[model samples]
Target: MATRIAPHEMPMIGRRELVCLIALMMSLSAMAIDGMLPALDEMARELGAANGNQRQLVVAVFLLANGVGTLFPGSLADRYGRRPVLLGTLAAFAACSIAVALVHSFEALLVIRALQGFSAAGLMVVPYAIIRDQFEGDAMARLMSLVGAVFIVVPVVAPSIGQGVLLIAGWRWIFLSLAGVSAIGALWLWLRLPETLHPEYRHEINVPIILRNMGAAFFNRAAVGYVLGTSLLIGAVFGYVNSAQQLIGEHFGAGTWFPVVFGATAAMMVLSNIVNSRIVETFGARRVSHAGVLLFMLVSMVQVWASYAHPGELAWFLPLMAANLGLLGFLGANFGSIAMQPFAHIAGAASSIQSFFRMFGAAVVGLVIGQAYDGTARPFAFALLICSVLALALVLFSEKGRLFRRLNGPVRQEAE
Candidate 1:
């Protein structure tokens, strides 16, 4: 079957170009999320947010809408092909960004943000399918790690970029700037990215065919729980994004350095992805990711302690939060590669469904944690601990209580 083709069995793109292009494409969603973070306060003040927490809803509403939108694009990509859906969404995303800049009220801003998020969802879904069309197992995991390493650069600099824009102009310019960035990405894809949908697997846009594909993707033992588990694990990361300005600025006293501080924490993720890319094939995704989940729980426990012990001390809180995020970087690529290993035939449909649950569920989890903030790190720390523990349980269930054993040997690399 085409799904079981050997690694690099099909046509190839220039490895370096492919990696960089995919990274740039994936970074659009990250930029959309992290770029506006610096603008939250300005947006709240101008739009008349009821309270500080209301600002978080900007991120929350976008995420929730992005999650909802994940349900369609993959299936559509499977039927219509990746290139068209991707270009269309990029255009739509850019249009929405402009709309967001022109909006005058908090409600209008959220409505535009939600629309932009749906476009972002399309951007998020198609790439995995594109990757799966050519790779699987440890090869896919390694490539994902590489893509993540490059992709994470956006989050690290996005806040700084947003802050820079805010310094010279109003928050609306941040949206406009990202809209410009999206245009560049769209043009790049149009000129270079080829359609990756395998001819044998061009899913017809129909109810029964879609259901069958969905069933195969969702019911598989290897994929479903891991997808859910990943959703649970990532909730804290999103939670952190939601409350970052409040936590780093107001509670920890970073003040005007909040963007710099946020960038520093995100920088840890880059290092983690680099390390994961290096060792994932050697140690195996299960062993590495399982260990990561355990470490995340342990780190969460310590983070909770430091939160209460030092209270408002940035010194104590920042490093611990950074460590947990670093551990998350280790888990993110591996978990996705694992869940995606079994569904190459239905990669588009599967990626969309998994992404839906991952984003929507994490958004809900983030909403809870973000809303529970009370000017202290304890609640956030505790939520992280809870999410880690629950994620471990789900991974354990996915493995039927098995842990630390490699199931599939990764294929040899071809210098890609």
Candidate 2:
């Protein structure tokens, strides 16, 4: 188990309502990315994009900017407060979405997308620090799992939503819809969510202090190791998402059935998160995630063998792939809660620094995994095994040769 903070006053809303609201706020980024996918070709054609690769940069630039921009909000929130940063981010996101719909040139569109992505970073980073403020240990993991279970449904349904919009209206309506949704989310936050950060934890926004506290977070052995390890696991998951269409549609010949197959595999993840929330408290986070890694490695071995022996049918491949995705529910949130255990005092700065690394590092690793795909699933299968193995090693390092052990409370904070 990870360390727990002393009980702070609870929010006005109930636990389930807070989880739903947090999940909705976080879902904006996913909806922006996934829902716009079906309109890429049309966007490229209308805006006179130079080539297919350049057209794809609409999504790519936003992701790059989002990762880089994660460095700001949590640190800013550390000084200003969570409510203001969150509200400003939601407003900025809505403005950017509306701006994207009005852009006439490809260059302009990419620029707006990058800005939108940077703004969307707060929707993710602040919520993490918020949840950290309210809960820790298995309770934090449980909250994260439930939040994830809700947030994840966006990806499963977003493309279909986009496609439906395109069938009846112009591609720009997708952005308009995004704008409407974020505005509603902003309104909800303004009305209901209370400022959760403790006043004693608040401090100056000076760069030296921010840097110093972030250094304290990273220098802690248990915290930094789990952060890096979780990023490696995230890379493996992102790599699968990057290549899913090619693997499921082309290699397995799913054709028009691709969405159904993808949705089914993703649905398993939702189920696993639900299961994880139910059991993480009983088994403990470390034990649960370690078991997940072991099982993931086993499934990857079968995948590697199967890919090499036969190209495989959809029936054979889908279930194995689903099992791998499902296991992440056991790993991601638990690992995140564990990583944050040592940094309650500097939660914002530490969260910003760690999130920046996770976003940037996972994207780089995932790009390598996706670009290495060679028609067959051999590259992807090997990537799964390699990433999982390395992640396990990192976890072992963090645990200092221990596994399945529980610590009673947060690590003692080092001197500033």
Candidate 3:
């Protein structure tokens, strides 16, 4: 008998189109979070937000929900395929957008936003599994870096877009705009994207299977260590997200200029991704990520000392902070690609476990750092320092005390 390839085991899709579709899908979550930054004060005022610090909850709860919801989407994608699950999640995301816009109370918006986060989880996670389905190793790392390069642009501009909407209308218009974007993305995806999961690779959706696969992923030293490292560093990312408005707008009195300041700072991530895309194929994901984390930790320590010395000074804070954040762009994609490298056959399940650890841990860390906000930047600087150091240790541990070495181990290689 002749061998047979499944329907999903075809040639790779057009790289340009696939990258765009995946980037758009990923941006849905970024838009939901970053776009709301410029409107937090207005949201707080109208929604009866309890206090200044409490306004950060608007982002925190959504992130927490997104992380929690990620626990399921990958397993579901593994069973049912990525396309149908992705489309359904997009619909849910769009629905939540409209619901959030229509809600009369802050509590109602938070509830709907949590649902929105759940939907965003599919957008954030499934695409990575899909990419894993198509590529592996150095190629996969390079492709992911390209995706991250494009994905970082959303954060650079989403706040400005939100601020622009606020100028023409109310904060509710932002959610309405998100609904429109989500609907458009869903339509584009429905038309263009195909199911990437090969039928032969599909797994049954049962609790025991899930637990077993998750256990396999957890037991992989490299995967778990990178995940833990990524988890801690993510606190720095979310801490910034949770406090950027206050740090730049209120503390620095940038106010109306918040978007410009935020966008400029975020542009560092775009630059970092562009550089990583170019260099990652040569340096290898582990080396680049290793160096990036160490640099981030060093910069973080400097920032902590500076923040304490010149408290509330945006002049000293913004540029140094931007440098610290740019390094993150290099770290995130590399770490994730390295972690997923070992689990191609079960990319969906592996991705779920990794995302659960990174995102959920990040949510907890972000909430704590955000809630600890004082009238100064010291808390955030301190939090970043702690997280960065811990992250470095975890990454080193994951590499089995080896840094800047090319890793060779049992790596899965299979047909798409």
Better of 2 and 3 by lDDT: 3
lDDT of 1 by residue, 244-272 (tens): 99999999899999999999999999999
Q: How accurate is candidate 3 locally (lDDT)?
A: 0.86
The lDDT of model 1 is 0.86
Task: Report, for every candidate in turn, its global Cα lDDT versus the true structure.
Answer: 0.86, 0.82, 0.86
On residues 165-250, what C-alpha lDDT tens digit does candidate 2 reach at each position? Answer: 98799789999999999989988888988888888888787888888888887667887777887778777766766666567767
- In model 2, pairs of residues that clash are none
In lDDT terms, which candidate is top? 1
Q: How big is the positional error of residue 210 in model 1, measured in Å on the Cα after superposition?
A: 1.4
lDDT of 3 at 93: 91
For candidate 3, list the clashing residue pairs, or say none. none
Q: Stretches of candidate 2 above 4 Å error? A: 1-10, 48-56, 414-416
lDDT of 3 at 7: 47
Best-to-worst lDDT order: 1, 3, 2
lDDT of 3 by residue, 1-416 (tens): 01122445564457878888899889989999999899999989998988898889889989999999888889999999998999999889988998988888888878888888877898888999988888777677878888988998999999999999988998889998888988888888777777888888899878888878877876788777899888899877898899889988988889899999998888998899889988887888888999999999899989989987888788898898889879988999999988888787888888887898888889889999988888788889999899988988888788888899875555753212
Q: Could you tell me which 10 consecutive residues in candidate 2 have the lowest summed lDDT?
A: 1-10
Q: How well does candidate 1 score on lDDT at residue 220?
A: 72
What stretches of model 1 exceed 4 Å from their correct place? 1-12, 409-416
